[model samples]
Target: MRHILSGIALAAGLLLGAGAPAVAQNPFEPVVYVNDAAVTRYEVQQRMRFMQVLGAAGTDAAGAEQALIDDRLRDFAARQAGIEVTDEGLQTGLEEFASRAGLGAAEFTAVLERAGIEQQAFRDFVASGVAWRAVVRQRIVPGISVSDAEIQQELTRRIETPVVTRVLLSELIIPAPPGQEDAAMARAREVAGSGPTEAQFAEAARRLSASGSAAAGGRLAWIDLENLPPSLRPVILSLSPGQTSQPLTVPGAVVLFHLRDTQGTLRPGAREQVLDYMTLRLASAAEAAALAARARSCDTLYAEAGGAAAAIQRQTVSQNAIPGLIATQLASLDDDEAAVVNYGGSADLVMLCSRQPALLAEAEAGVATTALADDGVEAAVPDEGALPSRDAVREEIFNRKATAAADAYLAELRADAVIRRP
Candidate 1:
């Protein structure tokens, strides 16, 4: 089931009239309206207040602007699909938020106030949050699917990737008494050339080596190749298994490494999986709309094959199959609004599908088995555990770039709108 979770409200500054009182709110003067609902000044302020309280660092003006836009988009999507966030949903959200923050709901509010967040304004923020998430899942998630090959490729890449392990040793050098520079060099050369055993090195460091690591026998932990300083990296990389590096000098001291072991260098390949099933064929657009209309209470609408019941069907299909949209927007559905998604047009709608991966060695454990029996011999389904192919990543990149396009498109929408500033 799509969980309708609460999100932070989008904030935008209001255009104030010269003679208007500071508290006056103008609903007609649009700050931003996603699909059509007014995003108010109070909503924006509460979001800002929360940002300040949470010490969130990335709230630049452009980010804030886009957040407001996304807020509207989500709310618009929800409304278009006839999704609504109820009072009980909001209360549950409040409790969830409090629990996440390690506070009681009442205590969380008090904390917000202490952080200078006003109560009612925070409420609007919560409401908008709930509403926007409703929109995202209803409108966007159905079209998203991951493919089996992509999952296999990702698994292969992850499993086959190699890691190089080396034992790194660092030392803090204490310059030998000035006149003893040549003697120090002699000792340094001896240590470098002798290849003393670790215990021998520790003893030599204690008696003759002028380094702080004398106490620890100059031992450093195993180091990943990536974290090595650039100057010593070439030396480290040149060494093979059971090899030690020549002494490398830094500004004041020297660093050394001993190549120990290497692991992983696995090539890419496919993985096996098993999954359960529920597929809802809302026969028509009318049926899709009808399902949306019947949705009411969280469990009630989802109980039998009602408007929101598809999610329950999905859950029954497989406990592991969650709504694929993992971002804040899709998670807020509260089950009811999430279950009845309005997929317009004549295409057969499938809802409440879930999967569980089966052991590869076991018979009949393959991705193709999870494919819709009616979808023909070759239909693609995503393996959630795998990396997407290049096309998929490219598509994701394109979708992310959509907001700018959406903004440009909306500008035309605004030009056509006969909006008046109040």
Candidate 2:
């Protein structure tokens, strides 16, 4: 399996246009160009090492196959959209990765180095992430869909099985001297409400709270309300934003909460969406210009061919069922229109056109079962449920359903794409 993974990696290396570089194989040169861009063996090795450390270090014959497929898809994407990764974007990515892993930039690099990964390779990995995500967003996400019933179902589930909403809070818990518990409690009392508003709580925490987060303000993060200390949950949730709770006795000292906000871990009913679209192909700059020209003569073509020249290829897709070319193009369109367009670009020219109304109706009908399910969520609502407004729920359902449909449509596209691997 590892060997298979390595083979796939090797194929990816080739697809990236990796080659040996140098005047006489200049030892100082660490990079080589694939296509019009430069990449280095150093970069690949570093990325591989990072992958290993990140536990993403696996490959098999199937892995190799997937890599080849991805490479071809990426090539098609690059040519279609003229996508390029930028240095600033790469830097931003590195910073984000480090932040997510709870490390400073320098510390993150140090860890990578300790793990035998090089900086350049890490950069390549970041760049690859940016490119791949772009492709997914561009070619896949737009055509995904969800239905109203899905949102309702999710909401209903949440109502039925509510998770305790807890505020995860941090305080500068100053330990009192053995004999000074009373004094500390007195001080805690003076500081509770008058000390900090939720927005100002961090500042107060830094200045007066006795804990580790003094430097970063009191950031409690996500805490489950049910799991909180018995005396803490009510105080935390009842206080409005910017309000502070009364000091309460705990094992060590007086504790209080500066309410930040409230969040619910509720899963409602099934959600759904309606998707509509049309697609066209423009393979080059000439083709884009010719679309207008062809449009002018469209009447003649319609008379001779029994349909517009554009009629040769058109797609109307639901949230769950979409054609691939249209799916890729839909990535650029709005939620309501992503699946209902013709999008093709000549090597340099790309155009996405809207779908016909009839096609949209066809898509809606096909995905109606899913859509109705999303819509029926509210009907299942219990009389005792204290839910948000119907409009808000409806909006959520619409967004979810549309997104789901677009996703299913894109999957179909990927499955049917005519990819040729080298």
Candidate 3:
């Protein structure tokens, strides 16, 4: 689900043209009923407009109706659980969410108002999310646990042992404008099947291809065959260098790929490590060092730093994708190990909560080389580091289990609700 706070900014852009005039709204007219609660037509219309503004796929009246129903269900469940978001808490949440777009809450709200969205409507949307989160934490966290054996099993499953094949491919995409799909497919078939030589293909691409690569004669960076759409993978693998694929009709376009080269390599999952970590930026090096010395685990840091506000950030990312300085600092640390680094007048306390080998997708040879270079890992020998700590694996497993439980619980709530549309 899209975060409510970020959705407001996106919806704001959509409301620019909607500020024409306000129609007198009848807030009491029921559009739908979930048990005893009534969802007003005014609210449904507002939600539908908001959906359109967010550019949601297939954002029609039907989808908007269903979404609003779900929101009502969530709101009902939250209220039953006594999950009320205080005014101060809601304000703080709005400010924190606005900070993601580098704007203050007041400034962000002003933009939304200019776009014709009511402040109360935005607040209601955010309140539902905050309340839902609280309910999930209260009802779901108690039953979740991760064992050492389970963590080991998860780590073992993530270590890939497959040999992947990569290809250097050139693409040509012919756009199928409304009512022109057949013509585009015919053109693609002709080009793919002996209609164009290599030089002719390049010329045709420069002239007729609709993709950005048309400017470069349809040349694409190396990509793993597996990375291509599932339907295209088998077709691509069957073609030899200098051969082209049959016209494959995709959404809005018909595509063709000219195989230029292929290579087989054993790429392990060692490069794919998900790191759950947190960074606390303190006012002084002395303060940071003191915190680091006292903190032994992620839980300890959370307890001590709860009130610091904006000075702490938590993230989960592939190890190779983290910033170079932090990645280097964390390279040798075990799970739950803390490191304090002083840079630019602030002291940063970094701790690792968990690490696990990641399930990696196939990539073209050139793409793999670039990724390895970025991670400061040699492509030939990617598995040069020590095994991830058990504690990190356990954390990952715990998170997965908790998420699954929460999803199931929400599904149950929706299924059990009495829903009627009139």
Candidate 4:
């Protein structure tokens, strides 16, 4: 979940030879192989030092190794997708990273060098992040969707009624086994492009789906709205009862949904309010409390967040799109209200800047949409363009879901990869 702007990306960049006795091994010797690619011992130590530099919480030797392993997976997936980071893009990433620490790129590089970190180590780390982003935004985000129903559902939940809402959906899950990924995607796309009718889709599911429901014509039991994946909630809501979804990529396969029916007494609620909230993670609980006292609004936190821009995040999203934990924190908060939540030794000061109704937030969010960065978990900048509030909401939801799908995609890549430790 660490962004490039992370005070520390990966984890404990343990100082090079901080205390360990000198060993007679080569730093550059290959230690792990991700398919044909090699991971060197030097890279692992460098990553550990990178973690130390960023002051990452709870970082250990094992966490550092796993982080590097994941980096290889991310890099491997990006390459397979034909994604690359240009020199200019890499430089921009470095500049943005340094600016977070209130320094220029060159300055940050000098600081790392002084700490005995190699320049290429930093570059490779940043490049991995930049390239992975391209892989997600270009390869995955386009296929994401957010239902008007999801948005309206959140707004409807405000109705204070006792009515329950549920969906009846049929599934067509196509397995995308290793060495057959492209063929599977092509087939799924073919099915989607043709827009199969309910009967035809059911038959295809029975023939093609790898899910257990295949025997039952790909039919699934009724599922509560809250029970669905956060990404799929809007997707399900957007469909009319009888519609089929574009193929959705899960960890191991592509899935198509046919919403069979809905049985809920629906009623309109209040105007949709897209929330504007900012969260800052400080080093400790005491620092979080200090931030809570000092920053009364999201705008004020920018000054308080110091050079760690990635440590602070701001988002304008549908209430339902927010993660369960953060959403729970924001639930009872008022405008400009702040709360301190602890995670181990680390802590976050979450503040609600404004909860404007859709109409009211249109001007701010529509004029410029937030752009994602740093593993696509943080929104660090805004893009210039004109979009309606609803569309902006949709974009935010798509980014959230796309990032999640990107993770699933990465996992699939790992599963299919030939990883080995030498």
Name the top lDDT candidate: 4
Q: Highest TM-score, which number? A: 3
lDDT of 2 by residue, 1-422 (tens): 21222222222223233333333543333343333333333444444445433423222223323433444445445456677778887778888776655666576676666545567656655665676557666766566555665655555554454444655565646454444544554455556635566556677677766777778787777776667765555556656656766555444554556666666554332232234433344455454445434432323323332333444443444445764554465556543222222234332122234333232233334522122236565444333224444466667766666556544644554675654322
**Preferred candidate (lDDT higher): 2 or 4:** 4
Where model 3 places Cα greater than 4 Å from the true spot, the runs are 1-28, 52-58, 161-395
lDDT of 4 by residue, 272-338 (tens): 5678898887788888888788876777777876686567888889787887777888888998889
Q: Model 3 has how many clashing residue pairs?
A: 2
lDDT string for model 1 (208-273, tens) is 545566677555566665576655566666666555455443333333444544433322222322
Minimum summed lDDT over a 10-residue window in model 3 is located at 360-369
- Each candidate structure's TM-score, on Cα atoms with residue i matched to residue i, is 0.35, 0.31, 0.48, 0.43
**Which is superior by TM-score, 1 or 2?**
1
The order by descending TM-score is 3, 4, 1, 2
Provide the lowest-lDDT 10-residue window in model 4: 8-17
All models, RMSD in angstroms: 24.3, 24.4, 19.2, 24.7
Q: Candidate 3 residues 152-269, lDDT tens each?
A: 6665554543333688888899996645654565577557656566677888789889999999889888897667776567777777778887666556776878888787653455
lDDT at position 36, candidate 2: 36
